[model samples]
Target chain A: MSSKEVFRPTCIIGLGLIGGSLLRDVAARGATVYGFNRSTSGVRAAIKEGFDVSDDLVATLQRAAADEALIVIAVPMHAVGDILDAIKEHAPNCGFTDVVSVKAEVLRLVKDRGLEAHYVGSHPMAGTADSGWNHSHTGLFKQAAWAIAFDYAVENEDPGKFWIEVFTDVTKLIQLAGAEAIPVEVANHDAAVARVSHLPHVLAEALAVVGDNGGILAQSLAASSFKDGTRVAGTSPALVRQMCETNSAALVDVLDEALILLADARDNLAADPADISYLADAGYRARTRLNARSGAHKNSVSPVKISSRPVLRLKPGAYGWVSTLKQAESLGGRIEVY
Target chain B: MSSKEVFRPTCIIGLGLIGGSLLRDVAARGATVYGFNRSTSGVRAAIKEGFDVSDDLVATLQRAAADEALIVIAVPMHAVGDILDAIKEHAPNCGFTDVVSVKAEVLRLVKDRGLEAHYVGSHPMAGTADSGWNHSHTGLFKQAAWAIAFDYAVENEDPGKFWIEVFTDVTKLIQLAGAEAIPVEVANHDAAVARVSHLPHVLAEALAVVGDNGGILAQSLAASSFKDGTRVAGTSPALVRQMCETNSAALVDVLDEALILLADARDNLAADPADISYLADAGYRARTRLNARSGAHKNSVSPVKISSRPVLRLKPGAYGWVSTLKQAESLGGRIEVY
Candidate 1:
């Protein structure tokens, strides 16, 4: 507890892989944590591991309310609404965040429940294909990027001091969990994750199906490439399905784009037999961009704390935070709370 | 030298990753191997590592012919025809095979050169995304599957005793390299690899392109799933392109199927939020099938050598090898060499 001065008590409502891991990570960082899950197995596993865990949702929220802890909903997207309702009933004034993969849907749910004022959206881009408490472990978020929500230009007071503290709390929590919290526009998060995260699951599953269709000889021949390409297909289907459904619009757009690219490659090859150049070129260019990001970040300003600049103080009402978030994102720097 | 009685002298034409690694493995297995490379650096690296390598393809082939060695053409598909022509000139009496990814195209090329009688189609399903001699290492094909082509219901001979020895030579080479040589139909190899290998490359590249399209935020947020899905996109594009082009027909078929699956998932999602169930169900079932194959293999008879059965003796001319290969492939077991 050497860092007691900046310590933020954390309460997680879902002891699945993400939730249980978050609980372990926070506790291991010398911070107080309480976790709840509907499943007896998850609670039992957490308690057996010597972590503070409970099966009663309302009791955990009540404890979080008493300690003024930041409540983190670690349930699947479909379960977010119910979790938010429970938090609102038991921990009405506690500032909250979530570890949901898709953000916009959870944002809407918070808005619907009149809990937006006390809510901060965040997603830890970590975890294995496996789920449940038994699979959870510490250091899951080590060196990973955590996307924390940023608001648009405000119409009212001095950039909303309350919201800044909420962000600070969330980022601090993320830091303790061993990740770089990157500030991002909440509305845009679903679209971005849909392309990079959601679509991959779908693609892996499709690859899996196609490999199976190759029959016996093909199955025996599947090597490292196929294994890597379909690695995510082994993930919990219900989990993947829920995430894609929550971000359906953006996932559809990106899935359509992927389908178009594949079709074009297939058609071109079918017609000319040597037209694989299309996909090969596009893919090479894309890989170059991916490589470039690593180098660009090395030369650019590191945005450990994006607000380190004078943007917050110079603002009349709303700050130019959009530009700041965009800059941090472009630089691919982690936002450090300290 | 412990098992020198079964040793097969190896001559490899091409010192790329696969070829270089094969030289290292075979030599480590106490077999005499001579490797030829177009690049001076490859030959230099192998020589520095105490491997017998040279830059003169003609001289290497001549040596192979003198020793009656098993010549291995381990270059790209587009380079195979030229290598076959060279082998026809200098090693006309030597039996040869290839480590090419596509079997049908190489089979056609060998047939065109009238070298089919002395040529065996083989593909070592190994190597990393990297290429060239520097990236090669020993035991690269350890425990990997190597596919050797079997002719379809042969006619006008007693199952071709020479071909059987050719297969035994190829399988022994694979075994010495620490791999399982799976005998498969040459014509079906292309279609099978198209689904399990070639199409995975295409899909990985497409995923990489889509991830790059997600912009800076998405790029920063790309996690293990995206990385795994797009891992093969980092491969040498020229190599991937050539492999796809060589098997364009089979690739097109499988690629089209993947597109249809993804498009159907997209359309279903667009129509109904709950429609993600289609892909989830199909993917789960496919994964189950993949898992089932492992168990099925454990229960069935193992086929280390397909000709181990009495069918070779019972056949008047054409052997019932199809059923044997099918059983081996279906069970998903590696064909061991005794």
Candidate 2:
């Protein structure tokens, strides 16, 4: 192990999908992993998945505190404060991080608790509709962007080498788990997530409610587009409620903007049907920019390689050869028949 | 073939994705399919796909007229009128249907052209992002619902046996191509598509525009939810423009409702931060209802089956037997030891 990566005996609290996934992957990557869950059933479920977990919070903390371990709090937004309180009483000096959807609020809570010196706030832009430890997989964070928000107070302060090493090790673990580490400020992270994640959830719920009013005909005729657009609305109500309550500030900002944009689109539809470019232009630009950013549409049609022997099998005519070569080019391939 | 299944020489106009898909699938199913395209390159592409396509509209019409074919107008909304005009001039007595998104407008245009006796408004709720004849596939309409709207004028009158036979044959063809034929009135079909299809497209466009306002951080943080929510936004601007313009009336209704619902959700997020069930309740119900309707969430976990086997190989200890039985049950199977 490197000098920077001395934060061992990694402990993950609340073994839901995210925490369980991290436990599996981090353990697989040679970290000494332990877990604790608030519910007995959750702890048992994690144990069934071949993970070491406990329902006892103090014992879980004491082990981490004595070992100078890194503790990842992966509970929902409402439960984060309780976990932080537990940490403050038992393991305040231990390295701590969190994976809640919101960041600014979490940082604030951590600052208020005076855990800033050993704290980092993180939110992984990843999940599936399924929840619980049973639904978690080791590859949950693979290829997803993991946002890391360092505590602003700690950032400006001259923290000792131990804290710096702990922060560096946490980043290394995230990258090792095959996620792109995107370092962002707590406020910026929350704002970005509100626009991208929380707004979509709210909009999807709204779309579903409005669609339900369209009667049986609309229900029967709903196709792939409708299905994809509202897929996130099928998430658990408790989870959705927690997210909405905790991140209401940033979510309300995006929701207000979306409502105005949607209303203007309706107005534009009536005013200038010929050029409803107000919606189309930005939509097209944003969509294309996202596609380019994600490389979603790149090289969908792969090239087919052909050898000279295959070309020789063609009929000995200029039209046949020219047409064959043109066909190959159209199919996104080249026939190198020398 | 049955007596009522006598329609032949299926003529498909504007050989884009829908028309080309129909041409390929119907031809494979033993129908003589001929195609016409407005563009030379489209005709060439169709020909490359082993379709008999022509850029000559009048000649294509004469061929259909000679064979008494069922002509399908599969063009964009703006071009529907031009094709209907050509159909009126060239093949007035033939069985006709259109695969446009907007049915009410098409029915009105067909009535205005005085071709009610030979027309049926049809919209196949199927497509991909990639358009044109080259991007077409045979299974585009597989398991999709094809909405069919009969002419109200012809419906009020006692349409002859021949018209009924034509409608039956069309439904049979749709079924044969692996799609459910949903018989709906013109107005109902338009309103339904607006709610399920057009409204989602508009909402997706609006979301992309709003997310774009969040700058680079929002773009970077945007993940699967954003991608799925805006999948249809990546559609061609020209196509989106036509759908918005032609179906603006129905779309405007849903847009207005969505705006109010979204604004209310935003308000509720602030006012009733504890529950927000006004939005979440309906969203949950609608999502679950859709999932049940589509058989999407059905059979998520399968039960294991076990056959009776000899237990002679096992040691006669109670602990071993109990442990073996428990282990079997945990693996989603039963211990069937004889």
Best by TM-score: 1
Name the fnat for model 1: 0.78
lDDT: worst 10-residue window of model 1 chain B: B307-316
Give the clashing pairs for model 1.
A304-A336
What local lDDT score does residue A196 receive in model 1, on the 0 to 100 scale?
90
lDDT for each residue of candidate 2 in A205-320, tens digit (9 for 90 to 100): 87887777886567767788888888998988778887777778878888888887888788878775445667887898998877775563354454532111111112212234
Residue B215 displacement in candidate 1 (angstroms): 1.6
Off by over 4 Å in 1: A1-6, A152-159, A295-323, B1-6, B152-156, B291-323
Q: What lDDT tens digits, residue by residue, belong to model 1 across residues B1-338? A: 23554476889899899988888888777678888999998788789888888999889999998888888898888888899999999989888889988888788889898887787788888978889999888888876788877673343244466666666788788878877777777767789999999999999889899989887778888888988888788887898888898898888889889888988898888985447887777877786676665554445577542321111111212345455555565555456433
Q: Relative to the unseen true structure, what is the C-alpha lDDT of residue A290 in candidate 2, on a scale of 0 to 100?
A: 75
- Root-mean-square deviation (CA) per prediction: 4.8, 15.8
DockQ score for candidate 1: 0.57
